[model samples]
Target: MFLKFLTFTIAIGGSALGGPIDPFGSSAARVLTQLPEKTWLESIAVRRNGDILATSLFYSSNIFTVTQPSVHAHNTAKILASVPEVNSLLGITEVPGSYDEEAFFFVGGNFTSLTTFSTTVGSFKGFKLTFPRNGNPTVQKVSDLAPFSSFPNSVTAIPQAPGSVLVADSFVGAIGRLDLLTGQYDPRAFAFDDMAVPKGAKLPIGISAMRMKGSYLYYGNPSTQSIYKVKVDSKGYLVKGAQPSLVANISSVAPGLDDFIFDPQGNILLATNSPENAIVHVDVRTGRSKRIIGGPTDPLMPDSTCLAFGRGILDTNTFYVSTGRNISDPTTSARIVAVDASLLNYY
Candidate 1:
C-alpha cells in the first residue's frame, strides 16, 4: 500500500522522542541516493556482496540497485529490473540457501490508480530473480497469487523449509506460503484475528512487514498499530495452538507501521512508522520502543517506508532505509539513507 492513508496521523508520545538522535558523529542520517519526484520506494533487500535492491511503487515499478552504499560520492541507484504489467512492487526477500548464486523472490500487483492505496484485487503476482556471477540477471514469473490473495505486501524466508517463503497478504489479513520449486501457493497458510484490520480503518492494511527469527514470525499490523509474533512449525505453518502475542503498541509514534528488519542479534526490531515519518527500535524482550532516527517534522527520512542491514562486516552496523516521496505533493522525492546502528545498546 502507498500513502493514501497518510492523512491519518498519530500523536507523538511514549518513548518516541520527537528530536533526531545524532549518534553517528556529525550526520544523523546519510542520504545515499535520491530518486525522482513522486517515486515511492517500497521494499528492500541486501545482497551477499552488500548491494542494495530497492523496489519502487507507482508508474514504472522499477527495482534499483545501489552498490557500495557506504561510499558518499555519486552513489545514485540504477535500474536493475522492472516487473511488467504491474504498476507497483511491494515485498521482496532473498532465498535463504542460495549459496552458489544470489536469488530473490518478489511480489507485484496493479493498483486502482497511482494515487489510490487499494489494489485491483486480482492483479497480484510473484516472481523469482537470480543474479549469477558471470552473466546478466534473470527474472521469471513464479506464481499467479491473485486468485487466492487480495493484497500481498511483504515476504520473508522460512529457512527450515528451503525454497519456501511466507508472504504477508495485507488485505486478506493472512500470511501465505509460496514454494518456488514446486509452484505451490497457500494463501491461508497462517491467519489470525489479530492480523486483521480493525473494523473501520482509514486503510484496509493488515499485515505489512514480516521477518522470520528461528521458529517464529514477527510482523507489523498497521491497522492495529501494533506488532505481533507467533510460533511456526518447520514447514512454516502456524503451530497448531500457538497464539499471536503482543510485541509492542506504537499508536503513539505513528498512525501505522510499514516495513522492518531485525538486528543481527535478533534482540531488536528496527521499524519504519510511516506517515508519521519516523523509524523506531523495539526491544523484542520487553516490547519497549524508542524513536531512534527521524520524526514527524524531520526532513532526514520523510515518509520512511522500508529498511535493511548492510551485508558486509565493516558495514554490518550500518543499515539502509528507503522513503516514499510525499504522495500529497508533486515536488517531493524519495530517498535511500544509511543509518549507523552501533549506538544502540541492547543491554
Candidate 2:
C-alpha cells in the first residue's frame, strides 16, 4: 500500500455510509505526463510489476509502457513497445503471473482479433490471439480460451477466477463471459434484460467499458449514460434472471457515457460524462453521485474517455484517466490525468 503523502489532506463529503469524498482540493489530481504526440490513448492497464501500459488506436495501433516512478518523481512511466498499422485498439488486460510471474498484457479492438504480450520482452512480444469467424461478425479467441464474435469493445479479467474473462458487446448492450480453456462465449453470465432504460432511453449502440469486483460485473452504456451491475455464478457466469441493478443514472448530466472506474476500496465509482464533459463520483451502495473533478471548470480536463487505476510509488492510490475531444475526433488532444484513489476515502 502506497503511503498517503502528508502534504495532501483528505476531503470528506456526505456521510460515511452514503456520502462522497471531495478530493478536488487534494494535491493528487496532478498531471503526470503527456503521452507522445499523435498517440490517441484509448485504453490503459497496470501490470502487477507496477508498469503502466497505454494503447492508442488512430490510423495505426501502438502500446506504450510507463515504468514505475512514472515520468515525474511523483510517479514513473516509460514506453515499453509500439505496434503500427493496427487500428481501433480499445481494451487491455494483464495476464496474472505471465511475466516473470509478473503477468503479461492483452489488448482487444477492431482488428478482427486480439493480442497478448510478455512483460520482459516488450512491444508485441507475446502471443497473437485469433478468433474464429462466425457469420458476418469476426470471432476472436480471448486468452487462448473462448471464441467470441461481434465487436468486443471492452474486456476485464476476473482476478479471483483465472482463465475467465468478461467482454462487453457494446452494440447489443450485453456482457458475455469467455471460458478461455473451453472457448465458449456465454451471454447468460450477465444480468442485463432486467435493467430499466428510462421510458425511451437511447439503447446501447455499444458497450464502452466493463470491470469486475468479487462476483459482480459492472458495465456502462455510453448511449444512455447508465451503469449496470450483474452477479455472476461460481463458474464466473452471469446467473439467469439476475436482473441488472442500476449503479448510476446520469442521462440528464451527459448525453453519452465515456467510461467508469472503481476506487481501490470498491465503494466509490468514478465516471466520465462525455456529453456534459465532466467526471462524477458515485457511492457504490447508495447510488448517490457528486462531481469531484472535471467539467468546464478545469480547462485541462479534456473530455474524459477512459480510466484505469495507476499504481503510484510508495503505496499511494493513483487513478489514470484518459481524455479526448470526443469519440469520433481522431485529431483530439489526448492526455492521462492521475488522481489519488484514497481521496474518495470510501471502503
Candidate 3:
C-alpha cells in the first residue's frame, strides 16, 4: 500500500476500545488550492480519474477542477465548466450512466443571493452535468424544484435506481427524488426533520447531509445533533412521506455536525462545525463517536465543513474536506484538502 501527507490526527471520543490513535504520520493531507476573492468552495464530486469537480456559492455558474500539482494557480485548477444561467451551485452527486456513458448532476439554490435572505421559502433547480473526458464539463436542466423543495442542500445519487437522485431540502425539511432518465420528480420521497428555531438562527433548521446505507437512508440535522436512518425499498428508494428514526446521538462529540459519508466497515464518517476542523467516526450500532481528524487537538489543520469519500480506484479510502472559518471568509488555511483515511478505516 502507498501513502502521502502533511499530518494525521486521531482522537477517540466515545468508545473505550483500541488504544489512542497516533498523530505521527507524514502529512498525507494536501491542500487542493488557496481560496481567493471569497470563492466559497461549496461541494465536491470525485471523477473516475481521481480529480475533483468542485462548485461554489460565489462562482455559481462555474465548476472548477482540482488537478495535478502545478507551478501556477490556473494550471492547478481552472474552469472545468461554465453552466449557463445557473446560480449558486452546491449539492452535487454523480448519476451512473444507463449504458457505457455516465452522467453527473448538481443542485442550484438561491442561498447566496441577497433577495432570498431571511426566508426559507425559495426554490432550486437540478441540472444534469457532463464532464467530458477529453473536454470541459457541461450542464443541462433536468428538473425544476418541486413545490415541496426549498433550498436543496444535498444531492445523492442512488446506485440501485438507474439515473435516479435524491435531493435534500434544508428548510422545507424533506427529501425529493428526481428521475434523470424520464424527467420525473417526486417532491417528497422521505420526510427529513426540522428543528424549532435555534436560539440564534431563524427558521427551523433541517437536514444538512444525506447518504444511502444498505437498505436505509441516513442523514443529519440540528435536532439534538443526531443522525437518523430510514428504511428503503428493494430499489434503494425511500417511501414518500416516511420519517427517519434516530440511530446515533453524537451531540457531545461534534455539536456542529455537517456532511458525512460511510466508511468501509459501515461506520459514520462525518464533519463538524463547532470543532470547526474535525472528522468524527460514529458507531451507529453503539451510538458512540470518535474524533478521528482535526480539532483544537491538531494545531496544523482547522475545522472542516464538507466531506466526500474519494471515488477513484486508488483513493477509495481517501476523503476530501473543505476547511474554512466560514462561508464569507475562507482563511489562508481555508482550502479544499484531501486526506488518506486508511488509518481511520482500519483503526
Candidate 4:
C-alpha cells in the first residue's frame, strides 16, 4: 500500500531559464520525487541527520520525511502522520533542541487550535512531532493560536527561548509567539501594514515564511512579494533597533516567490509559481537577485514552492527545490529538484 505513493521518476536535466545549463554540475534539475496531484509541498527543513521533513500546502493531510534523493533512485518517502483534512497545514520547521528533536507544523482553517481530535470550534493551530533518536516518534497538538492569529502560516523556533517560536499569519497580517511548552501563543506582536511597503502585487495571504540569522529574524511578505528582516534580542523580543525593513522584492524577479532557503554563504534563494524562475538567488547585502533556474531554461520546474540546503558533509553545497505547479493539475508535474551549489561565487 505504501509503495503506491512512491514514484520512480526520470532524471531531469534542465534549468528554469534561458537554455539548459548545468545548475548542479551533471544534474541541473532532476525530478527527484512526485507527490499527489491535489497536494503541494509547502515548507522544508534539513534535519541534523541530513534527512528532510516537509509539510503540504493546499489539502495534503500527511507530514512526511525524505532521505537524500539521487538519480539512481527516487526519494525514499514515508508519511509520519496524517493531519486534519481541512487543508490547514501550511508552514513547517525543525527544532533541534538538546532535550528533544522535533518538527513543528501549522494548520489554519476552521480549526481553533492544534488538536489531535476534532472540535466544534476551529481556527489557527499547529502540531509538534517529537522524533526520538533512539525510540519511536510521537505527534501531538502544540497550540491553538486563534486569539493571536486569523490565519497562521509559517513558524520558526526561537533558539534563545526554549519552547518558543515566532509565527506569522497571512490573513491577520501579524506575527505572534507560540509557547511550545504550554501549547499557547502571546498576542500578535508585529503588523506588516505598519511598515513602509513598496508597491506590488500583494499575495492576499500576507506573510508566509521565516528564518533566523544570528540575532535577526527574516520573514517573507507574500503581499508585497518581498523579504524583510528585523532584529530581536537574545530572548526573542524585538529590540529597539529592530524595525521591519525590505530585504528584496520579487516584482521584477518572478510572478511571486514563496518559501526560500539560505545558501551556506549567507545569500538567499527563493521559489516561485511564475515561469521566470523555479529558483532565484538574492544577495542580502546588496539586494541584487539572479535566477538559478526557471525562466525558459527549465519548464520542468514550474510552480516551485519551497527549498532547503542539503545537511551534512556528504550533501554539502547541494540545494533542493520542491515544485507544485499547474494548480489545475498539481500532482502530474509536482517534483523535488536539486541544484549543485558547490561551484558558485555567492560572495
Model 1 residue-pair collision total? 0
Candidates by lDDT, descending order: 1, 3, 4, 2
Q: Report the number of the highest-TM-score candidate.
A: 1
Tens-digit per-residue lDDT, 171-223, candidate 3: 76677887776667786767643422235553246787888888788888854
Ordered list by TM-score, greatest first: 1, 4, 3, 2
Q: For each predicted model, how many residue pairs clash, with residues at least 3 apart or on different chains?
A: 0, 26, 12, 17
Global local distance difference test of model 4: 0.63
| Candidate 1 lDDT by residue in tens digits, 30-134 | 777777656778888899889888888765577878776665444667777766667888888988654567788888888766554767877888877777776
Cα lDDT tens digits, model 4, 130-191, are 66656666566666666535556677777777667778776666788877777666747666
lDDT (Cα) of model 3: 0.64
Off by over 4 Å in 3: 1-28, 68-75, 112-123, 132-136, 192-204, 239-243, 296-303, 324-334, 344-346
User: 1-347, model 2: which lDDT tens digit per residue?
Assistant: 11111111111111111111122323647655554334556667775546566666543354555556254444323444333323445566654434224433344434432222111111111112211132211112233222333345567777767666676655445666666555455653453553223345444345567777778877776655667787876556667767678887765555556667777557544546354555677677777666666665464456666676756564346777765544445454455666766664333
Clashes in predicted model 3: 12
Judge candidate 3 at residue 37 and give its lDDT: 47
lDDT for 201 (candidate 4): 39
TM-score (all chains, Cα) for each model: 0.88, 0.70, 0.78, 0.81
